[model samples]
Target: MSNLRVAIIGCGSIAQNRHLLEYEENKYVDIVAVCDIVEERAMVTAEAFGAKSYTDYEELFSKEEVDAVSVCLPNYLHAPVSIAALEAGAHVLCEKPMATSREEADQMIETAERNGKKLMIAHNQRFVASHEKARKLIAAGELGKIYSFRTTFGHGGPEGWSADGENSWFFKKDQAFIGAMGDLGVHKADLLRHVLGEEFVDVAGFIENNAKSEITVDDNAVCILRSESGIVGTLTASWAYNAGEDNSTVIYGEKGMLRLEDDPSYSLIAQYTSGETVKYELGQIQSNDEGGQTNTGVIDHFVEAIVEDKKPLIDGEEGKRSLEVILAALESGETRKITQLAK
Candidate 1:
């Protein structure tokens, strides 16, 4: 196909703000349909993108001639929609965390294998230039032997940022499964794994509901990870920080330390034991309807993956690994003990 026809499931904020707008800038993609249980949302998104709209994703899958699809539904629906789309013969780009449970993630992976379709997860942080550079430096042994790290992704909450905030499906356990850990924590977990090139062997964690009392799921979480390589680290994710701190990651090694934060001025900073520090002024790549939005690199990666017939850096299995870390954290939080990763 000269150009791939695409469909989007779940016409929610992510579809409208990130994926749809990013796709608009890609020359090799033609959005053919948009599906959401809320017909108005689907219609609005379809109209905005000049595509057909449907309330039933299955109808869109059966009727639309799409080569790929972006599944932006809630956590619980991610695996099912992705599996269905893959089985229907379309490449899938599902949002993280991969799935609510490992069983569902395995099923999604199995379906992709059976259908021979690409199944990528939207672990967008992996596409950032600073993140890419950091990974390269780590891989090149620029930092020498690694020690420990700290990472965080937090905000006032998903309320104003989401279509309905606390009332949005994000707060619903049946729909979202896990709260902050799945929504934001998964990013750090995956990022740590990506940069460190290590698998987490165990985790201990805690969760709190200091905000968004309307939700039954966790609003804040903290976890410690012990990697198979013997490196250790901490990850924190919260939706209750009204002070509005964006995501940040810090890494320490025998020779130096690296920091990546959402500050508009300097997004990347590095300090060495030799009393030298480097700062990079990496700027935004896209505009958000509101503040603190990151970049469009992820959308470009998705398009490139389809055009080049290459697997995405954050494919389904990679995403599942991230989710496994967060799930281990949740289990640790509940049991108040270190949870071993089942591998």
Candidate 2:
């Protein structure tokens, strides 16, 4: 088969760090065009990749007959841009939170389905080595009868990691929709669901913006999630971890417990009830810090799904399920009530 012609719709940090780099490395992909509202950013990225540059996504789509596109735009544009790409006869790998609302998520999914294009959400936590190992252990009953878990994704903030630094869209409520929850919390929601292989059925949360001044979005959020099998856990997302990042998860089970991305030396540690402790030295989880570049496995999977005509693991429906958890948490925070998810 000919190389898949790909376009990146945003010249943001995510596109530069993950989508553009990984796509360039993929033997089956040819980045045909790059687009951003900032013409200079698009030009630089396109020049680096030997692709065309466009200030407008619609113009890029109209001109370049791309086989796929990576939607790295702001939260508000994920649905519309991905839907447009799908309608234009291209598969889409959209960054999470897939959409601002469930309605928009549904629309994106519908558009993809109607156009027969793959719609994959880039929830990279699911692709982590330790996470994959943990999921397999749980599935094989190594962690028998999973009882509870706590997954957290926290860092100083997105300002340093964003293209615009302090003026990044990540700090704006209008552009980001939800702050820490959308940026980090949704990742845990998707990760938990992926590892547990169950949907979150209930959520009660507390969201606050006390850390960052002049921001209309939450900087810290904690959500209590109950999975479909009645397994309960806490998901915390914060932009106030000034000391360092804390991207870790601990799962408790009847057999024992599993520690993931918690230890500095080992990525996963399994402690059994019989006092047997086993450690797995899987690679570190990707972070926003310097020298944190790692193959996320998201782009490769998306490309493979398209090449093989198979649905991606984190498809539109899966992404929507994860987004619903964040939305429920938002509702819970506002109403001070435990929100029940629709099964």
- How much lDDT does each candidate structure score? 0.85, 0.94
Alpha-carbon RMSD of each model: 1.7, 0.8
lDDT of 1 at 314: 81
lDDT of 2 by residue, 302-339 (tens): 99999999999999999999999999999999999999
Candidate 1's C-alpha runs over 4 A off are: 262-264, 284-294
Report, for all candidates in order, the number of backbone clashes: 1, 0
What are the per-residue Cα lDDT tens digits for candidate 1 across 65-123? 89999999999899888988999999999998999888999999899889988888888
Query: How well does each candidate superpose onto the true structure, as a TM-score?
Result: 0.96, 0.99
lDDT winner among the candidates? 2
How many angstroms is residue 37 displaced in model 2 relative to the true structure, after the best TM-score fit? Answer: 0.4
